[model samples]
Target: MTTLDGQTALVTGAGRGLGRGIALALAAAGARVVLVSRTGAEIESAAQEIRSHGGEAVAVPCDVLDLARFEAVLDGVGPVDVLVNNAGTNAPMPFVAVSPDTFDTIFDLNVRSTYFLTQAVVARMIAAGTGGSVITVSSQMGQVGAADRSVYCAAKHAVEGMTKALAVELGPHGIRVNTIAPGYVETPLTAPYFADQEFRADTLRRIPLGRLGLVAEVAAAAVFLADPAAAFVTGSSLVIDGGYTAQ
Candidate 1:
């Protein structure tokens, strides 16, 4: 495992769930972390938790949807050696019932935010000649479609495509871009859905491993992709879905 010692990593949506887990993992691996989220106090608490473990971390309250501000992200974050685009949301709805607002909301956060945020960070990386790793948090839905999740699936698929294209374009600069697509990760936002036994049982049946994924598991993958040891990896989707997509 390549240590990220002396590296500075910026992770969006670091207030909770997979984002928070990834931030902590990167910090544990010796990277100074910048925790970004729309909520200030939440990420601040998370940052303090990292500091409690003697890891360097800073809470940066930010909305990645603000592309304009991302142009100046370096101004607030200084130099980011690793960029994790993890801020996203999903709303499951029947395809026919998906409204324009629902579509826009999902796409704006999942697709547009991911595209421009990476653009800003990679641009800065290029100018400084400091190549970095960009790990986008995608979903198994990106690879296969699901009922009532049409909009969400589309957004993730768009991210999957964008990541590949960006990886190719940024490879010349030594910047690596890839995505981590996890399936059925148990998080706060998903705990409610799993409360319904039918949904839970069906989801479990599809996963060969017989359980939902853990945030720590996904976080571990993010660390691997961010490490310098993965220098040769790019335009790839590392799926941590317990063989859900294998079928």
Candidate 2:
């Protein structure tokens, strides 16, 4: 593992699933990890898990949508060297059935809050004069749309656009901005969806690898982006989709 011994990493939505996996990987790699989630007990458990393995970690509970409270809590975390904008929510519905509230709920957390949170973190990185990496956990849907997922596609696509713009703007400051787009990863959030045999078979058929992605697989991508070895990589999308998007 490329060591991040003295660096600090903050991962949002880190209570479980991909966020938890990424937080664990970063901690194992030696970065002091700050795990943020709306659920206090969950993140606290994750933090304790890291500490059990001799890694440094901190758990912070806050709703990312609450900007004022988030910012206030962030102030106490000190300098962050790597930021993973991983907190997001997706509620599937047909395009015509999408109410205004549904759209707002999806876009607010997936796009709006993520955009502003990154802005805040990037600003602090600039002020501190320390170069860093900003990684957003996007989705293959961001590059291609699917039925009943138009809103999610829109939000992820917006994230892709924002990342590129930020990369160009922050390149001079040595801040790298990129995204990790995963396709149908098997997490607690998605396990229920797989209960339908047809859906599971159809999903696997689309992926050339013919299998669901592992949390560790996606977490490793986050580690790669944060490592010094990836210093030259920015404004890029690392798609861990088992070739799903390739088709």
How many clashes in each structure? 0, 0
lDDT of 2 by residue, 1-247 (tens): 6488899999999999999999999999999999999999999999999999999999999999999888887799999999999999998988999999999999999999999999889999999899999999999999999999999999999999999999999999999999999999989899999998999999898999999999999999999999998999999999999999897
My TM-score estimates for the predictions, one after another, are 0.97, 0.99
lDDT (10s digit) by residue, model 1, range 126-218: 999988899999999999998999999999999999999998999999999999999999897789999999999999999999999999999
Best by TM-score: 2
State candidate 2's TM-score: 0.99
C-alpha lDDT of residue 46 in model 1: 88
Alpha-carbon local distance difference test for all models: 0.91, 0.95
**Candidate 1 error regions (>4 Å):** none
